[model samples]
Target: MAMLDVKNTKLYISYGIVGCGNMSQAFFGRLFKDNKNKQRRVIMTYTPSNTRAHELADSIGGTSVKNLKYLNHTEVICLCFKPQQLKRFLTDAREIDFSGKTIVSILAGVDLKTLKEYFPNSPIIRLMPSMPVENGQGISLISHTDDVSKKVLDELELLSSKHSMVIKLEEKLFDKLTLVTSSGPAFVYYLFASFAKSLEEAGIRKDNSKEIIHKLFLGALSMIKNDKRDVEDLIADVCSFKGVTAAGIEELGRQNVSESILGAIDKGVERSRELQSEVRSDLPNLQ
Candidate 1:
């Protein structure tokens, strides 16, 4: 029997990911343990022989294996491969039995119909979770059919504790989220760095500037979470028309940087949609 059944106190979750690259390591190594499997007994593995994969698995406490048969006994498998690596999984993975399992996919372009075609009988879910899941601050945007209910959603929410945040989404909206949240952090990091660098260049010491940036960013995020004010409104609260914040805003406006950021998001969405199309052949609109 699969070890993930909630009623089983001694359950073991077997996660079989197809890739062990950065995303896999970040997700598995950083967040898997937070599941708090008191037994320290979750069985995890991924496609092997790749150096990055092995390194990440070791970092995350997962066993490494190259054989697909390892999944035959797994209960919860999160496929973390790139789009180009999927067909091989579909072809060779058919021999395994997944009668009572859930398969979560992280490939950008693959859709539910295609996932169903390969693992037809298993309950399937598609999502694009950020790598920050390792840090407990990551947001995971997920979409699926019939694999969860409110009760199940609450159960899954438990996984978010101390290490991750999950937002349920309409399957059709996964594409927008893929770019917004999936690929968001790295981009945001660059923006955060710009803010910090500006402070440093303004004569603020590097460490002090970083502390200020982090505190401000955290405070801003908290406000967004606890209040009804929209993000722009919050920024407006800080920019008193001709004040320091406004001055910075005007400078950014002159540089057209915000537009460039928006353009980057648009391009990322388009590219993700294109990849999704190549794999699913009939993915719903990714916008």
Candidate 2:
């Protein structure tokens, strides 16, 4: 078991990472941002055709291992590859022993059952994290096997909370949460881009239009975060009887925008399920 060393009121741990991608960058970036846990180092890393491993290792004072075999003795492994890459990664990692290790998988649509099949000797935790984790403000949806020790889970939760909100949910509800928490940022970005394009069409400077839309979103998000009142009530505050905002709200209502957005989310959920099915079918009986 890895133990934490406390010095001058700080704690640190030793962990390893597999697959260094954008999401891994966000997670570890946030983890190392804080001075206290900056000492909680990544001891090893493996990247598939990316400079991320060496780059991150150099920045964090760690070693970049060319082969997955280096992770065999790691106490905790953060699995950050795509769901579809699970089988390929495992095949490439045949020489790496996962016995008694704790595997934290951030692959979307790969559930606990499938993870257990691939890393039967390790306790698996399925986590869905967003890109905002890079700034220490995101949400991580997690589910774990029953065999995980309470101490390990607590440590994992603390590690995640350093960068984002961590919510524990059953495997059944993870796909639905993935739609909002995981993919929702892109949806919001798309909405803002569309709004910015409209502003540009109205003769606003292109750069100004983008900046204005960005601040508009940042302010709204801040308001929602700080306000205690319900979102509907807040909307009511903005759309009080027969004003410009009211006209916009009326037009959106007439176009059934709410239903349209919900429909989009439903479609995303369906695709998530399909991906899960495809991965499971491809990697059946991995053990």
Candidate 3:
């Protein structure tokens, strides 16, 4: 592996991403496209099947390696594989020397403790990025082990902040917040789809309804950003007393929509914990 060169006193961070899934493509694709400083680069991309690896690597102008041995050449290794695949991946790469390298994991429900058990000598950083990163609008939750160096942490922050709003969080809070930052996009999309469907049923053209709902969300978000008023105040401004919007709001409250949303989040959090337990059971030796 070639060591990082000193260029203007700044160290270049090379990443070896292990999976070529949608989330990986969304985050890394935007990062490579918008990066102008040339301080960060994708060294290699590896997957169980070489096809997706080749595709992603070609798109980013990085190498596509068929073997885990090539990962040793990279400075930071980003584990983008599914949490359930951790055991298989670790078993396959058991011989690779991850000792001085930084491991950036985006495997949901896989905690730092589990990762450290697999790669005891490596510094692990857990990152959970939302699906909106594909559009260059995302919220990423990050946490790291104590052994990670300040330089690596700063570089990761800069790299991630290019396509997402980075927030530091305690490792224990990761699963709970993953429901919000990671899974929230799908929930929002579901809500929009419901609204669009209602519009379509109310005599609007399907395409027009979808577009109107899209623009509605965009405008509402813009208002939230530009308006200084509280969210409740903004909602109040939208709803006149006993008006159409107020009627709908009253019905939603009557149906306990807020409680339903909270209940959904609770279910997701419980599933995350179940996944962690399943992973531990699968790899009992690591427990």
Report, for every candidate in turn, its global Cα lDDT versus the true structure: 0.71, 0.80, 0.85
Clash list (residue pairs), candidate 3: none
Name the 10 consecutive residues with the lowest summed lDDT in model 1.
1-10
lDDT value for model 2: 0.80
TM-score of every prediction relative to native: 0.76, 0.89, 0.92
Q: Put down candidate 1 lDDT per residue, 112-188, tens digits, no spaces.
A: 77777666677777867788887777887767767543333344444543466677777777777777787898898
Error at 183, model 1, angstroms: 1.8
Sliding window of 10 residues with minimal summed lDDT for model 2: 1-10
Question: In candidate 3, how many Å is residue 67 off?
Answer: 0.7
lDDT of 3 at 78: 91
What does candidate 1 score on TM?
A: 0.76
Q: How many backbone collisions does model 1 have?
A: 3
State the TM-score for model 2.
0.89
In candidate 2, stretches whose alpha carbon ends up further than 4 angstroms from where it belongs are: 1-13, 34-42, 284-287
Per-residue lDDT tens digits for candidate 2, residues 1-287, read 22332232223445678887788877775665553335454468788764898876765666678888878757788888888888898788889778888899998877788788778889888888899988778999888999886656776677777888888998899998989998999988889989999999999998999999999999998889999989998899999799999999999999999999899899998988888899988884733
RMSD of candidate 3 to true structure, Å: 4.2
